[model samples]
Target: MKLPINESGLAASQLIYGCMGLGGGWNRDPIQSEHITQAHEVVELALENGINMFDHADIYAFGKAETVFGQVLKEKPTLRENMILQSKLGIRFPDEEKGLPARYDFSKSYILDSVDGILSRLNIDYLDVLLLHRPDVLMDSREVAEAFHQLKSSGKVRYFGVSNMSAGQIRLLQNNCNEKLIVNQLEMSLDKIGWLETGVHVNQVAARDNVLPEGTLEYCQLENIQLQAWGSLAKGIYTGRDLENAGENVKNTALLVQRFAEEKQVSQEAIVLAWLMKHPAAIQPVIGTTNLARIQGCVEALKVTLSRDEWYTLYVSSRGVSLP
Candidate 1:
């Protein structure tokens, strides 16, 4: 069964694959046109593996990402019916376009203009999901909602959501929004335990990795919003030598991943997916790996389960201490 997406109730996969780093068009010092071909291969792989949701943002590679994805749709017109295409608006990259500082714009005219740019570039009649890339502090939610309402009423966009917003901010938007706020794109991971705001002893055990946010899971759960986890790889902080620096339980959990992967005949990365799946809250991982084999490994994680003891072992390791 397709999962319920917002109040409009579109069916979507629980795991939404992110097409950011995989696209090769984002932030490349010298972006090659040939890289777009590689991006299509990723789309092919996603379709082959049953990943129906594709995430995009207008500011990505300065609209080239949307163009690349549009090419896929145009080349294979039939694929559009089966896939749920999503894109973001409101992030203006002035540095990329005008060689000036970048800024966020949420004016009604700017929102409509961005939507047109998204539609023209994607070559789609409408978007399955349209999100505000980030919150604009001066955003007039009523004016923004007017555009959303018009878009929804016109069948140009089916769903509305926000990215990287606080619970209070979402409520503020929802208060003005006639349509429901569907998802909150967030940065979440095993190493980043801030989602649940799990009170861990950082100074006593290990220094906190500033990469992950704190208390997002609990807040999202309370607000009835979905969390999209980004950069979910087992890299950084404990890259190699610091694997020991990461703390003892962390080591045990890693050993556990090796053991489980061996037992299940899957890659260690699959164990990471399994661990994320164990969370009670809806954690739709936005995986960015372009490698097809690695992508397959992530899918394998969905099928595998981490035992209760093992889940805690990793959790304890993440905290660098036994659960008190």
Candidate 2:
């Protein structure tokens, strides 16, 4: 399925290969040959399986994720043309030496500089989409608009979007920027059911406790903004994560996932992802597994189709409660 990334005839894959696990561990570790080999294997495998959209962030692996990915592009530049390369910026990790706390930045200069850094590390000229990693509480919409204008005018980025933002926050940024925000990525998965709960819990006590901003899902659907789901795999919770210390609801959900996988003859990863994709919003799930077998398992989701009963069964099991 082609995702409506923009009106410029650019479309992304139904699944996005998240590169957070690339370039070794998150530290000042050097990019070793093993890391490079693993990257090549992952990229080659993902491309072979029809995943043409890759997601990245500057903060992933202390910037080494993009760095190693750059090696893949450098070795086989043609691969760059076949895929939709996307990366995000704006999150600044804490630096004790600089006397700085971890914070988000959306200042004009920071945006421009971050884009340059992202492009440089990825060894790319322009990004298919550039997302502000998270909303900066101190963001000035006008200032961000101006920065976007410069990036667009100079051909540094083709499109713009935001991540981890609420509907109200998106509206505020949309009001100031000329660019139409095309994507709003958030944590959505069977494990993170707040997005679904917000809709189902209306006029009920559960509504007050839902973490997803009300109307966020509907607003994205109404605006034609592509909703991408990060943490969509829920860190392998239901699929195969150890449930020894998990709650009753989680253990039950995991068992149900296995049952479905067995009945459908697909990987548990596929069932987990298919459940998320069943939503009408057409959410693009970002899968970050570095394991080759797990990556192959994730792509199996495209083959399985869960009916309404199956979908709700997983949902109710995960929530451990009847719908209000």
Candidate 3:
């Protein structure tokens, strides 16, 4: 339940409850007023299960995610010190009146202003972590570094991280920013690891190639930055579908795995989570499930150690082929 720490020395739960799903549950539908109480109650459930970290983005549900998270904090303000609350900035929501300014904003002025906005929304004086939601190709390292310095010195944000950034992009800012960015929350999952390879996912075949380099994975390991895995359930891609091994075989395999999950006293989601945790790298999987039962199952992944061969088997299943 304790956090998986990184080089910059920040730590929080290995299983961070993604707040996007909180604004709207798995159905991507808003929680009704009747459900709001229990919805907020889920925060306590997550915390009791050792999930002290919560991940949210500024644009999630057009900012309702942070608002709801703020409500949870207000209801349990005393729990603030016990948890590591985090959110991201950057993605400007579209507004016709605002000249349709839908784009990534990493400018110094934007970054500073975003902090104040998030502070007011979350009702927290300071954040445990603040991430640049995604890389801005036009990002100026000097501008970002200056904003980071100001935020850290003013105690507006205690820790810094980046999301959806490549190894090189992170280095660009990391080198410039005097305050160390503690982590990089990449959109990584075993299935989404096309970033780890150099195919169409990385483009020997596309015009604008995937920015992730072949050495990206190796670089993170060498640098000691904890990779937070998003979309860990393959975005529920295999829910009722076949395992990569056999199309017709999924019904039974899925049922069997689901049964094992129950017998092992974990949800099916946890099985996927455990698969990620099996990796040696200090990676954390962000779980977006709103069901407390499923949330608890994900937390269980930290202890479920898959054997080396089993790990590859799952990898092969995910790839729909054996490794070369």
Candidate 4:
């Protein structure tokens, strides 16, 4: 279940626990004792189940998630050495001083300040990896490179990567940076099939209309960037409202997932995640569930293997169309 993070030689669990839902909710609430207790339980469960990588972001629960997680580390000081911690930066919420809409900031000063805030909130000396949360249209690659250089040189961040960026955007940053970008996190699931559809529907009229940017998957694989899939379960399609009210295609796909789960004697969540893990790119699925049982159920994915025909069956059903 361990995978190498490119040439950095760092190994992380194939499954990453996402902490977006940890701090009581995604609002500006203060971190309560209950939040800390919940986070501690989730972290312990993840570690006991062989999941060592914990994903975080400065904006998750308005930073309370990291605050709660930091409290867990404080109470159990020895747990820090056993985990791979990664957090994201660069997403700026709207503030009164700016009086502007929320946007991304990749300036050297902003990057430096953001990392400092992350470290302070998490009560940690450094992050195993730091990811730029999103691509900023006004980003200066040189400035970002300078910030990265400072972070690496100061031992603040061990590795660097990005999330929700196109291949061209990643190239622009990687060209100027000394470190190789090792990971690109994107929304990929059985329901969110744009990443797969674009590849399958190539060279025809359908290909041009694909919403997914072309060549991103191929580019990441070719460059040895580990593609981490966010929303990997598609929000429990079988149990979600999409199954009850959606068209036949959506329902059929959900039914197939359920059938596969039953046949494999695993949870439907595992079937969905295993579908993504079956790809050749060695994609890692970030599980965001805070439910302990659901989190434990997700580990079944590591044991479920789909055949080539079964994989295509789920793919075409989720796409709501056959391969041309």
Top model number, TM-score: 2
lDDT of 1 by residue, 59-121 (tens): 777777777778778888898898888888887765766677777888889988898898887
Sort by TM-score, best first: what order? 2, 4, 3, 1
Q: Which candidate, 2 or 4, has the higher lDDT?
A: 2
Which portions of model 2 miss their true places by more than 4 Å?
none
Question: Model 1, which residues run further than 4 Å from truth?
Answer: 27-33, 96-100, 198-216, 234-253
Models ranked on lDDT: 2, 4, 1, 3
- Report lDDT per candidate: 0.74, 0.92, 0.73, 0.91
Encode model 2's per-residue lDDT on 1-324: one tens digit a residue.
Answer: 666664656777789999999999899979999999999999999999989999999999999999999999999999998999889999999999999999999999999999999999999999989998988999999999999989999999988899999999999999999988888999999999999999898888879998888899999989888899999998988887888999888999999999999999999999999999999999999999999999999999999999999999999998988877
Q: List TM-score per model, in order.
A: 0.85, 0.98, 0.86, 0.97
Give the per-residue lDDT of model 3 (tens digit) for 1-324: 565566545557778888886555434465465445655777889888888888878777766677777877787789888878889998886579868867888999999998898888788999888999977879999889999999999999988888877778888888998877677777766566565444334334542455566656666677776778888766664444445764533344355446546767766677677777776776788888776666776777776766686666555665554445
Error of 1 at 182 (Å): 0.8
Better of 1 and 4 by lDDT: 4
Candidate number of the best lDDT: 2
C-alpha RMSD for every candidate: 3.8, 1.0, 3.8, 1.3
Clashing pairs in 3: 3-12
Give the winner by TM-score: 3 or 4: 4
lDDT of 4 by residue, 1-324 (tens): 788889988889999999998989978767788999999999999999999999999999999988889989989979999899999999999888869879999999999999999998888999999999988999999999999999999999999999999899999999999988999999999888889878887887888877768899999999999899999978877534455578777899889988999899998888889999999999999999998999988998999999998999988887777778
